[model samples]
Target: AGVSQEFDLSQCVREPIHLLGGVQSYGALVAARRGDAVVDTVSRNAAGVLGRAARDLLGRPVTELIGQEQWDRARESAEAVDVDVDAGADPAATDSGAVARQDGPASSGVLPMTLEGVDGPRLFDVTVHRTGDLLVLEFEPRAEGGPFVFQNFYPRVRRALQKLQGASDVTECCAAAVREIRALTGYDRVVAYRFDGRDGPGQVIAEDRSEGREPWLDLWFPATDIPPQARRLYARNWIRVIGDVDDRTAGLVPERRADTGEPLDLSASVLRTVSGYHLEYLRNIGVASSMSVSLLHEGELWGLIACHGDEPRRLSPEVRAACEFFGIALSLQLAAVAGREEADELARSRRSLASVLARLTSGASDDWMRPGSGLVELLDADGAVLLRGTETVEAGAPLPEALPGLLANLARRGAVGEVWSSDRLPEVLGLEPEEAEAQGVPAGLLLLPFNRDGDLLAWWRHERPAPREWAADPSRPVRTGPGGERLTPRGSAAVYRATVRGRSAAWSPAQRVVAAELWREVSGLLTRQVVALEARNT
Candidate 1:
């Protein structure tokens, strides 16, 4: 048997990075101010550009750093930008006054400003968002190419979107998106990682890499790699970049305000530094710099577009914006592809089910138990059993005599729903290994309820020794070192095999869809049959 360990709640909720309480770790310069616009804290990077240390900048006014003239120009730019913006705003934006009133901009807003650099005054793009009573600002030096050069990339973005729209499936769309993004951003590798569920493991579904790189396609990463809080942050902040992992992080001078003794909330700031554990994890993976664009589906985080570089690499704001645009386009395409595939699968299932219904209505005795019309074939199961009151009809492999009673007890205990499925029946049903083996019972079951009196259809699958190929040993979820037990990413990219036992092939989304539709049709038929029998008796 594969190694198993107890679940740790701490791994899921631990958020050391969020506690840092400042955006000083971001690649660009950052500062936070009170509602009255007094600078509360500034990053070391911003202090360097201003030719002042962090201690000198603390408790100063924003005007002092940008100069009074540039500050006025920035306010004007912000007002103009606000007017041009529509009601559909970015989710990361917040205004202190509006937040106090329980409403505001959906996300941070950007303003064009000029700031004093070591050499001379330089163009900077400033983004501002409110967190609690503080207004956080991020500053990035505007590239020399300017808006004109950034606008030039639009055609390429449009082309990529068009190609994605043309993709017939999710796999093709992801592959195309990664290739296009890697080419646009000049990253060494790009991968589309999709979460299995809200807090489940993530799998590298698609990837594209530069020459001589190892592929991460089909690799699965545990949920502990990205804790719940980090996921929440990702959903709020769509784009995150680590320009250089080796770069030193600059801490806030005071760390907290003298008056309030409260730390600044940098949740929406791009300059927020990640946790040391995450930095170590990335370092272990040999990634010097990386960027991630959150892939959202219906306003929820569905996955991420991960870009990894072997050396320190910085993407201009223009390029990062382009990647974000592509991520949005890819998200839409993924939803469309899934919808189309489900529709096609439903059609096929209806056709197959219709044939079975026709036979049932023809008054053919035992037709319900026949091979093609039986519940087994309808759900693509290895075997099936239908329980109607005291009557039981079975096909394929025989079920254990105790199975029906076990299912009935489950329904009474609220374990049954419209449809209940389990790949490992022994674990789910609490059967000992020896007991399950002695009965020669299958390891998978799907129960579809028909009525309240325990009348249901059960599909069964024989134990299949399916081998899983993992990028590393999944059994050993974490490693211990002198620094203590850390949830590090697997060091080895080589394949590790483990044969899954006491379990059958996993059920797919399409199969579940078919089972649901079949249940509805069968329930209606059973209701009609009962009505006819009651009428005859009367």
Candidate 2:
């Protein structure tokens, strides 16, 4: 491993990647303060790209390089780049230099610009953005003084978007998006990866790869592959591209910002250099170039349109923008599909709840506790128990003799109801593997307290029978760092099959919501019954 001797796990999370003080070598960077609009920072290659040394470029008025008209346009456009998918410009409005040789609003100030270059005149696709008071510009040379005709790519992408919108489910949406991106970008591999949760591991839900490329579809990747810092950055930006991981990085002229005393934050820069650790990670997996289009939901990173190439490949500017737009559309579609599914599930649960509540006043006081009350099935629980003083109402399954004592202990620990939940009780009680089974109690359960007499309603779930498929050895995630000692999570494409014998299936959001709704309705009915009985006695 080429890891530094000082490397440690803590450093991995704490690495200030935004302050790397460099940009990718595929382009050059120039930045100036908004106050005086004088050049304050430039990438080392600024002279080669802008035909001026970084030293000479510094302290010069920005108007000396770019016209005042262009400066104002760039500023307005940078702010106008909305993260909202609906706010994106139509493909017809894309910059012609990168699209159809006609000028339009560059997705990211991507208009063609001419400047004296080290090799004479250079036509470049310029990108502009801001980080605090500094306005930054990146200059990437145009291949053959032009780009792949967006005119041709536009029709294909239009169809792709229509296909994506027509997808009936999340799996369908992700798979369709993956194929479109692969076809559009010509990457050797493309994957639509979904996170288990905001902070959990990721699974490759859909993948499209070139012939003979190792299949990564359905593989699991550890969350550690993306550190906390990297995740935060991904959530903020819509796109990132690595033209060549092996290319030398261009260092900034001044290492730190004079005002903030920190390396200028390039969190939004299109050409910001990547982390060394990440670069090494890519090398470990033999990836030469890569790109990622973030799939966001409600401002959080839900997943990514991840692409990779075995050789150094830089996509034309418009292609990158189109992929970004596709990601935005995909995110919205995926969320909508999931939202509709959840809405349908919730509607069914509500219908069940309505039927149960309708029988409340018509049936006997004890009738609501029967197996037909729909309470047992509302949360997918195998059984239900309502303990009132010394008496107990059981449905679907018989209660253990020690039920009262267990409920009392849980109430004292505040482990009942919202404080604690199903699938966590066994761990919280520190029950041994054999003890959980021998106790004849549900391995998982949910509960709601009724009153001070230790009265409550509880639902139980017994142990499940299936084993889980893990991407790696879950217990031993430690691995050797490439060339540093790193606490590598899951990187290798391998599988680990493991079973947890003592636990039942984890409760889902649908079950929780349904249970809560049922509790509210039933508790209200019980209160009304208490008042009616008192009136009759009086």
Candidate 3:
């Protein structure tokens, strides 16, 4: 048999990312300083408004770049804030403070300065941070439209929050969020892409788009689309923009850090250049410009608010700040909606289980593991089997002959949880897919152990073929390239079918909760039954 050399593009999700190099193509001008002197700089031509190329600014005193008065104020502000950046700490931990304070009040700590522009002196809003031995300065132009633009911006954010507050569920809130974000940024399309779990695939749950465009609603993208390192950058930065995909990126004058001899840490940089692979991926998807705002829940990346444009577009600093604010507001609303939904579902399941427990305690001759019983209904499984000592009672789908040995081995290896479940039993049990299918075993299995001997209750579900619609055929994920093989984004936007095998319907959160509650109740019942038998013998 010939082993195919075709590259699995999905493996790109595990590829290592170098985050701290290259200057971003965006407009923000960046320069590194040590004490009161500039060591290196990277500026766009548009930054000529600041009056010098990156090379000319190098080896110059900071006082010459910005007036002496402005430089002094920046130093004073840094000392007043007493910001600390631990070099050895995780980048994520060190960068959180900057992301958290990005949306603070305009006057809170902004260092206002006047730099010599090509025309004359122009005002700029500068933010300073200490990264290891370097003082990184990021400069943004003052709004030409003035402070009123910001005053109006805050009200719009308030209105978006009010709309979210009125939403009754997670879906409704996500829909409202995409709409509001599109309206605020004027993007051609806005989508709320949520991850299934950590390192899981993402799905476009809600979308708002311009007329005459195909919608990406409900479309799923593989986890490899955004690699782990990219996800880490999203968590640290919270907001990123590609002003124009075709624009060339500028490079830092000195590529390596002066002290560490490693790449400059750009984790907190607003002007960090994106990876070439990511840029190509966007081009394949037909996006000209893009912006992403991270939606973090409980310090973990839950999803993203993605904005795309058909034409090159750039958001002003103020506008980008507003988008970030909207993302924060939306994250809070999503958490509220999910918490409420989970609570409501758990409550319903608890009520149902309580009724079953009452009947069981009243000497009712009910087999809880049988079809239509509370345990079966609670877990939402098609069938269940109860194994007590040497006796076995099966209901719904027939129990497989090999299940007992498999369960015993799993328990011995500590591979099974207190209440373990899997939609694809073949993968979890290390069985060959073909052999699993041939054995006539159900695709789904849930085990609840009742004793150290591996005696337990088992729930089973027959295989159910679920057809997934993808933007392109996922099996052929990569294309042959001039340089051996390289990962490429799915080129076709047309819907493609993929039939999922070796799996059954997933167990819902509500079902899991009910299973845990039923386990406790059943264990108590078994204990009581054993006590009664001993009393009779005595």
Candidate 4:
């Protein structure tokens, strides 16, 4: 029943995964109004998990199920989490991985409670959070146990933090992270997947896996693998788990809420049932169970600590929380490493810039276009150009003769005296494919017009021949499910090799700053030249 027609990848992005009206059967959910504490919604399996009738659950105070004191503590814990998030508190500030006695709360918003049931009492670790106007409490029964302790995972995570913080570079940091995650989770494989940029393709930079497993250590995955909607959820939630892809989901009672006529928004629910397409995708990849711990930086979904198990595996809520804590610490360490690298790069750039400036200042003439000015190598561009009035002078590789006309059109669009750039220069200039190729057009352009009259310094980058390796053919990203019920993006294991064209390496923020600084110097030189010429004429 696989799709025979061209696949529409947009369907994946449009799926409202968070509004799915079910929860994983391993846990049961109960929701009550935050203002009134009146029970309004519960998963159909809530009665089975709580050992009470579903009818008896609704229209009662939430305190009836959870004792009044635990209820207050849950609310207080949720509010504390909210405050921490709002203030952007350091992830290390709260150690959710701390071990506790079986009778005590494992972490904030997670506590053990024995609820009265039809037959004696059942102990569960209750996870509490708020979604919209509702207070949601999800209950997962504890494994038959003696004294439960988070000792195993807590120490591993603590060790992981030490390694992450001590690492001097991103490569070392990521390698240490994956190694610790694999050791802590016992997954067949663990990898750190880093996105190229916002919503861009990702690559598995580092991996720790079983000897028998195929290496995905450096494989690249298209952004479509995790669609935009999924990215939004990952940015909001720190952890997501799928115990068994084959298990049927427990339906939510009434499905949609009576007030909004919409399914429960489980954006923050740890046990929320996931997209069927995602489940099928995991199965295709030979993963029976999986977990993703979001790696965030400055509130953005930067990457993920992804784990895969060959057989169905379920982790206790405590284990998952500990993993989440490790992810947070790793993110902070990543930021520190990146900041240090950027600072070093800036230091080097300043040294080179000062050298270039000294040469320009010592010159007998004001013209910085001279060979020793280093303008050609300043931005690592393939070529550089100086354009004034109607004249154009170039160095290094040749630029399109029509480039001057293109710049005039750009100025007409009001880019005068402003910095402008594009990695896909031909496309931005509105040239057709044939036209661009025939003209041997550069793929990137950066312009700094010193004044509104359109006199400018320009840099161009030639089309870089880059061959990419995608997990699958990006054009065939989806196919109808076996039963033609859903669209899935996974099926083939063969890597797709493609040569990407019409684009150049992107300019970084530091390069842009350098461009601006250069512009100020250029403007001063031009002003002095004009004043000297006028003085001689007078």
The number of the candidate with the highest lDDT is: 4
Could you give candidate 2's per-residue lDDT for residues 198-295 as a string of tens digits? 66667888999999776777777666677666766676667899999998999998998777686766766788899887887677677899999988
**Candidate 3 global Cα RMSD:** 5.3
The TM-score ranking, best first, is 4, 2, 3, 1
Better of 3 and 4 by TM-score: 4
Error (Å) of candidate 2 at residue 271 is 1.2
Candidate 1 CA-lDDT value: 0.68
Return the TM-score for each candidate structure. Answer: 0.80, 0.83, 0.82, 0.87
lDDT digits (tens) for residues 1-538 of candidate 4: 3555555776677777877889988889888887878888888887777876567878898888877887787777665564112212223322221111112111237767778766887888877777666778888888655223678567777877888888999889999988988887799989899997767778888999998877787777877888767766676667889989998898887788888787877767878999887898898788999999988888788999899999988777777878888888888899888888878777777777777677666765334666657776877888788877777778666666657666655654435455778887777768764577677677888888867787788888877756877777665556665455443333225677866667788875567777778777777877898899999999
Clash pairs (backbone) in predicted model 2: 1-482, 1-483, 2-483, 3-483, 3-484
| TM-score (C-alpha) between model 3 and the true structure | 0.82
> Which portions of model 2 show Cα errors greater than 4 Å?
1-8, 84-108, 117-119, 145-152, 387-394, 397-458, 463-471, 481-493, 499-510, 533-538
Candidate 4: which stretches are off by over 4 Å? 1-3, 83-108, 144-152, 362-366, 409-419, 426-435, 480-493, 527-538
TM-score, cand. 4? 0.87
The lDDT values for all models are 0.68, 0.74, 0.68, 0.75
Task: List runs of model 3 lying over 4 Å from the truth.
Answer: 1-11, 14-20, 26-49, 52-64, 67-112, 117-119, 127-134, 147-149, 359-366, 412-417, 430-435, 481-493, 528-538
Please identify which of the two predictions, 1 or 4, would achieve the higher lDDT against the true structure.
4
